[model samples]
Target chain A: MSTEIATGRDIALIDLLDRLLHGGVVLAGDITLAVADIDLVYVGLRALISSVATAEENGVPLP
Target chain B: MPEADDARLARLKALLAASAAEDAAALLAEARDAAREEARSILQDVWREALLEAAAAAVEPRPPPERRRVRQEEGTAVVEPQPPEPRSVPQEGTAAVGPRPTEPRSVPQEGTAWWAYCVVPAAEADRVPPNLDSVDPSGPVEIVTCGELAAVVSRVPLSEYGDERLREHLEDLAWVERVARAHEEVLEAAMSATTIVPLRLCTIYLSRDRVEALLEDQAPGLAAALAELRGRTEWGVKVFAPAAAVAASASTEVAGGSAYIERKRSERAAREEAHQRTNECAQDVHARLEREAVAACVNPPQRREAHGRDAQMLLNGSYLFDDERRSVLESIVEALAGEYEPLGFSIELTGPWPPYNFVLPSASALS
Candidate 1:
């Protein structure tokens, strides 16, 4: 078994979307546009209402 | 295989059509183990802090109510009576405008950009098998090596991914799903090959030279992150309490008080006590899981609309620990679930995911 439990039935993709879009290393500045560079859109789309404050508080450029 | 197994295989095949058969079989087996008879397909089964402060701060954490309101009724952002900061929510009014990039953006309006997916040591870069598809398949997935750092990239056409274009694409749920799936498929393939430091989705550079510069500039920090994150995996533990169950738990025997004042007071106090108890259950669970995790993060609970559930979330937590302890951690969560079931609490364990939660935004944490 894959050391994982059954969770997020329909929403696993949602969680994956959250991580793909928000989680992972941020190449902050310099050079071209990192997703992080131009993320206010995606951040606002899926996470605006729910996670903006947490993102702001954590300073993670998320949401 | 049994008929049930065959049915599951069919479902997996339908939900994901591109996975290699071997992977499907393997995930099928795991999904079988995770079978909770919930009548849903979840192969997509896809952190923390200082002990005291984080746990304390996470209880019922609420941002400004205005900020919490989405395009419900009014797409207008609430102007703070006193205004905390001038941080504007761009296109806040256009949220419900339906899958259209409404944000105003100013930058790079021409030429293609290399969308970087993840980085691995140059030594293992060759192992990141090619031929895999990416967010945009304008070019084959390739690697750019700078010293010991290697970036996995796909050359994307700028017309479809430019600042304004991409913002519009992000608004389209169908579009984001397709792109997100493609993005994750690349990382998952790389992961199977070697340890990787995943770049946030949509990391793009103007040219190969810019990508190389990134490898050079972030080398030490990146290397440190790779070293620190080498074998660890991120697992999520979410505790949910169905509304009815929690409500029943909150209601107490009203002491047969015939007096209206007495019954009213008791009922209100009972609800207050129940709310406090729920918070305690959450913190108690977090403390227990924290002991076993090298790092932990308590995320804001996913709203009911977002999760598509009728239950109230007690905890939405992520924990990172040695991969070898995966089964052990699973057991701990299963046991915890049973322990809290009586109080209307249910815990779920899902993981073996790429270490997304562990990547410190500032890799300097390693330095």
Candidate 2:
């Protein structure tokens, strides 16, 4: 019951990360620092990412 | 130098000296008058002109126009009118203007890494915005070109972005927010000027050479991605079922026990019918959007815990379209909104962003 509407230009942190971390042209390289270890980091960020996502969904304005 | 040229040089030196002295005094006075916006603007103009004159005087003794043009094209000259400079200035003036003149290009001492923002075709290398602030404010964004691709990159301290330190930073929500915003800011600047393949967040390399090597190694794949993204942009569309209205419609009552039982059964049936209708509506919307989009992808519906909304997400889709189709897609969204709003469902449209979803190889292909 809490889903909120969002426009394309909103530039919300959740949306940015959704496109930035979840999508984009990724090239695997030895020297390039990959987000490959993201799983390890995501475990720590799950709470925050989820909260922000929830905030966006609930129409709560993020600071 | 000729006698007349020597005399002109002397005159310029005298002017510069006078302006330098006057500038110091005017700067002090300008500080006192800072409260007055009009006075501050006039002082800024004077300072700009003085700086320009000094720069012109310094370059006066250089070769004539033809030679200077050649040098500029060769990338040795610093004073040429660069096209990307103007666009690099933050339009909102919230952030500091582009990089400072003294910003370091690279740090080779060691324990430093290069964070690459995006890549553009080598032909558009000159279009890369200069003086852009990167995730590391201390480092300025620069381009590393290889064959046909140029990587937009900035140098960062490895101690901060190295595997361990970066992993730690990512855990800090505030830190992640700042770095992610900076990354997008640089991409937005580059996107405005050229077709770019935005690298994923936190993409870093050991050095500039490594970035160039990456460009060389990934040339084929990168080229294909760029070709697919040419003249196209990504848009997002989401549909939500209005929980309150749907809940209200599902609520009903009857007085008698037999009537109540019958009413409950019919209510369950009606609710099931509405759910099916909602699913059908979502599918219809996606089908219509796909027809107008050059490429389309449907993302999994977000969970309620993640979105913090009680409403169920019926659709989450991204579309890629050409520039001219922007209005067409917009109108379609408008029509969809109008048609669905009355059915206890709402549609939201977003984009014209870089083709983030379309350029990447599909997950199945990668697997």
Candidate 3:
């Protein structure tokens, strides 16, 4: 367990974009939405598994 | 036989508990009833506030000519053209985009309406016609706009899984997929124009008025937000390292050896040391790359069982950059490839996606 603060600037723009694009205040509106019959969890899991599998199959080396 | 019977009983008990606990039908019924009551309460609380805020807020009177739009070109649907007037500053940016040319109206939902939304600027409000792209686009896209805020409402309800009867028969994986797709559609539509504020899954608004009021309440903040987000786009970059290759590199980097046993042990230690160093290198690469980009976010890297591949995912990163700098960013990534080639790691960048993670509540709404 190393307690350290790395002090070197000059970070990449992509990294900044990642935070600016994906990180923020999520406003969950007070509205109930009807969604399709399929499940979101399964979709995510399946996508994850298949993408990994595809990577392996395509020789991309799954991590 | 007795042990097996006990296990079966335990399974049954678990099933019974789930039925009582998370039954979708009961939850939906409860939520449905609650939404109705909550809707009324929200209306009551905000109705007065809405009127007061709209009056106090800077409600620019319509500049008549800016309201008329050039019709969509033949066969090519286009988002709103650049605001007819040019303004360099923030306050002026508000005037540049202007207000919704027409008042928003509600279309009735036949059965249950599930709210699906991807946030777009109020300027692109007209592009999302009501009931436009519902699973069956047979109807108009149920669009409701307020100032610079727009939500493409869908009447399709997500299937309830909490009901014991249906839960037993339901394919949960299938249900989530359908909902995600609905989310995707709205998000895709939003991405086509400006950075969209993606609403969470299964959010439903009972009436169009609430959305209008919401827009009214959040307008000033949303307007400023639109100005901030107008020109930028998002991209993703993930860095992965092959575990086997890392291990191999480690073994090959062994230092001096004396006795056979000591030498063999030293080789193993050397491999572990090299592996740790490689992991560190991978992290540095991602962190440095992110720091160099315009804006970047590093999400928790997901770990899974090694899939007989030589790689370990060291970083999963998303980036937001302006279009002009897309190539500049890509070049930086290419440069990283050259630098980290010796470490047996690779950086994969994918995107130009909607700013799904960057949606913020209008700041004025907070004040």
Highest lDDT among the candidates is held by which one? 2
**lDDT tens string, model 3, A1-63?**
001111122323323322322233223233221122123233444455567677877999654
For every prediction, compared with the true complex, DockQ reads 0.15, 0.13, 0.11
DockQ of prediction 3 = 0.11
True contacts kept of 1: 0.30
Under the 3 Å rule for N, CA and C atoms, how many clashes does model 1 have? 10
Candidate 1, residues B1-367: lDDT per residue as tens digits?
8999999999998767666776889989767644531121121110111222233346535443211211112211111111112212334444221121113333365787788888898999998877988787688899999998899998888778765676567666667777777777777778767778877666667678878877886787788767766666777788776464344332333443246335545544655555566667788777787778766766667655466555767677777776777667877787787788876777777666666666644322212
Off by over 4 Å in 3: A1-25, A31-63, B1-110, B128-132, B135-140, B158-171, B245-264, B305-310, B360-367
TM-score, per-candidate, Cα-based: 0.64, 0.65, 0.53
Candidate 1 ranges beyond 4 A from true positions:
A1-11, A29-63, B1-108, B245-263, B363-367
Query: Mind giving the per-residue lDDT tens digits that candidate 2 earns over B53-96?
Result: 33222322333321111111121111111211122222233121
Worst 10 residues of 2 chain B by lDDT: B69-78
lDDT winner, 2 or 3:
2
1 or 2, which is superior by lDDT? 2
lDDT of candidate 3 over B1-367, digit per residue (tens) = 6999999999999999999777877989878865664464356335433432222221122223212111112321112212122312222322211111123322232434435465567677666533335532333456677766776665543233112212222234444444445445555555554555555444444446756665565555445555555665656666665454334322332333235336545544654555565556556665666565555544544343322234655566555566667667788888888877656666776655555444432211222
Interface RMSD, prediction 1: 10.1
**Which CAPRI tier for candidate 1?**
incorrect
lDDT of 3 at B193: 44
How many clashes in each structure? 10, 15, 70
